[model samples]
Target: MYPKLPSLMDTRIPTFLKNFNLQAFEVVGYSAINAKYQADFCHVSVKDAVMKGGGRRVHGWALWEFESHIVGNFHSIWERPDGTFVDVTPPKVGTKVIFAPDASLKITDDGTHQTLYQNRTSDPGLPYIDPLGNAANHPQWMLENSNPSLIEYCKSLGWNNASMA
Candidate 1:
């Protein structure tokens, strides 16, 4: 039998927050996993256009462990249940992915930076966040922008969501 994988909530979340000096935030959404492939990791293409003139994009077959707990602009956690967070996105290149919730909070805390575009209309009840842009939205972005071959690969793996799962 396969070993039980650790939960992202129990492991990676704390380390991600502590590493970046961020406060805990709610999990917004997540890609559904197929029961048969529960322990297997999938590759996803994440777009990092938030930094430096539309930014560069990276494509690879790295195992993706996604969690949406933290409130920010990042899409995937790239973290293993073993508490290792990998930044497979292009923003930091080879560095580990860090959620900059503190930076996001600072913008929201400062009223002057407020703008309607920054606030997510999907969930109106929540406080305004991501004055710059939220990486949290990137998974969907990746799905929307992904090629047909990648989409087929994801579907074959039982990623049922319209977006990458």
Candidate 2:
């Protein structure tokens, strides 16, 4: 049997996201847009969808996994006129994503987005940290060990720190 997935309202969610009123949406699969790499082009794909008169774009956080921890990745999806949300880009894992919508944030030319983390591993050696204060909430290891180009791209996006690599 599969393990239970946590809800957006789960108590384990970090304090920073509590006030945002995050919601969970099911991943609709690969988008119909003709992008070279669909998985790597969420922001653009959603934009294309809207430009083609498909649906309006909605910006928010999508749950992702990094180094065994659940991370809330800054992501975007297409919301139909009928009020249904669809994940235009494929998720890194699972069939659904926990999304925290923030309509004020818009997608820019640069590929920049925020990330939040929750350490669910049983290992007591690595305790969870809130507001991961070391610059855009990115842990030092992620910055130092990730790809340099990705890091530079994040900087261009105004993250003030490298994340989501």
Candidate 3:
């Protein structure tokens, strides 16, 4: 059993996301047309990490992109006074969140269009601070420490495949 997680509407947005410089880059070619008329917003993706010792885990959240339209399970970005980002989708008690510097952009196959944004980092093992205040192996460690309430919440949100792993 696990403690109740915060309500989805109660989590706050991070300051960096709130003040994210949308004008820092321009949409080019075909994507630009979509940007002009669509509602621009940010995307958040939930990630997991497990500890090496046992059934301890920590979940991490990443900002996927600043988009002209909502896509998938993406949620609005939130900020903290210290300029860190937070995703309220999961249980806040034992979760760890991170921002991958490398995921802050998107490029076209033909090298014609480039968009400034952030997305999930490819490396699942990215080191992050755990709830215990120690560095833990991500994704894997997070899986081990899965919270029942969060897992149930995720399932309620339609992540039927959500697992302790």
Candidate 4:
């Protein structure tokens, strides 16, 4: 059974510092100007935009929906001087993205970005431990709740903790 996905209003969202606003932004005219793999370098793109002109960096999470779960990946976007937010990174597919701004989250030195995963359905029959965004620190939780593919992906990254029982 799948765990139900939490909305911004859900009290279960751990460390959810603020309401996750549903946002849709346009990719800037020069989004791909200096970006290599645009989709993978959102932080860089936003940073470059801020450096080039007059805009502040906005930190938040970008939500990606999968069949089994919805993942919220820590991300950054650009807020123009006019107070309008825009994604300076070229999206991999569609022009739109689901973004949630969290003023509290920021890029850190560890280089290990955080991601939150929530089940698509709330099935009480299943073991419904809430998914932690920082699975790298929770080996046991990773083994139990994370999908097999994700565990394998972690292994490829040399995350030995994920391989532990």
Candidate 5:
């Protein structure tokens, strides 16, 4: 059985504040432009900081586990002091939504465009996320109706029908 979405909560965010912030490399949101309707957001989790090295000097930079969430069930973004926040989800609002924590979102003059916080690549700013995922809300797949690309790619290996290696 798959999961289902609950609601959307868009916090009110003013633009003037979002002037100076770095945009996340890849922001996500619900969209059917390419496929099925869905709500997706990007987030990250952090484990205990581990130092990598011997002796008094640690060489490796702080290690981080980078991952993407296609549908996080509930998406919550932290707001900057100026009310600007890095959009965890790209503004698409495909159809429905889950938790938006913020309030009603403020649309910009340019349709399909929203101001996202951003900093240069040199700046070290990463989101420490506690993501909420719901399997029911994700895309459904069936072995009998698997993606054609995968089937074709597998066939190239010379495997016969009904046999997978």
Candidate 6:
């Protein structure tokens, strides 16, 4: 084993948050008991983008436990230097989120940790929370300008629930 990794504070938690535009991730389904959410059905809320949910916390800040259940990737969706959340996933707009540590596991008795990689194609896939500058939307900033179709698209995707996209 490489060695038991330290707490979120001890690890590279801060740097990760600085990079995130909002929430750490977009959780798509329930993994422990069963997968209740489908690939297309899950919609995580983002923070501070002004869709519905919106707010900004200090960097490297620690959020609550429930904040984690929605997003699972811990290794990648870590924290920021100011102690706020740095969401790598497509953020919602303004939802306060925290890492759900229960979503992850240590997987060893010796103490070292191994991260389980996740993606849209994988089980418990990665949630696409990136709300801004989507080239597919044409010019990306269309989100800010509030294009008619973009508004409808954002509504259909449940922008209210997203944390920081």
CA-lDDT, candidates in order: 0.31, 0.50, 0.27, 0.47, 0.24, 0.28
Q: Who is ahead in TM-score, 1 or 6? A: 1
Compose the digit string of candidate 5's lDDT tens values, residues 4-102. 332222111111113213122222233222121112322210000111111121111111112221222223333333543333233343333332232
- Per-residue lDDT over 82-109 for candidate 3, one digit per residue giving the tens place of the 0 to 100 score: 5434443342233422332222332222
Candidate 6 vs. true structure, TM-score: 0.19
- Taking the tens digit of each residue's C-alpha lDDT, what string does model 4 give over 1-165? 322324444432332222233333222322444434256556545665676777898866555443344445556778888997787776654554556676655444222322332321112232122344322322122123254654454444345433211
Which sections of candidate 6 miss by over 4 Å? 1-10, 21-36, 44-165
**Runs in model 5 lying further than 4 Å from the true structure:** 1-41, 45-72, 95-165
Better model by lDDT: candidate 3 vs candidate 5: 3
Q: Write the per-residue lDDT of candidate 1 for residues 77-131, one digit (tens) a residue.
A: 3333443334433331222333322333211112222111222211324322353
- Sorted by lDDT, highest first, which candidate order results? 2, 4, 1, 6, 3, 5
For model 2, residues 49-155, the per-residue Cα lDDT tens digits are 66565668887666443444444555678887787877767655565666657564543322344332332221234333333412232221222325565455544
lDDT of 4: 0.47
Candidate with best TM-score: 2
TM-scores for the candidates: 0.25, 0.51, 0.24, 0.50, 0.19, 0.19
| Candidate number that wins on TM-score, 2 or 6 | 2
Q: Return the number of clashes found in candidate 5.
A: 17
The sequence of per-residue lDDT tens digits that candidate 6 reaches over residues 1-165 is 111222445223433333333335322222211122122212221222222333432222222122222222322232334444444343232232344323322222122221222211011222322222111211111112233543454455555322222
Say which prediction, candidate 1 or candidate 4, comes out ahead on TM-score: 4
Clash totals, every prediction: 6, 0, 25, 3, 17, 45
The C-alpha stretches of model 1 lying farther than 4 A from their native spots are: 1-22, 25-43, 46-71, 92-97, 100-162
Model 1 score (lDDT): 0.31
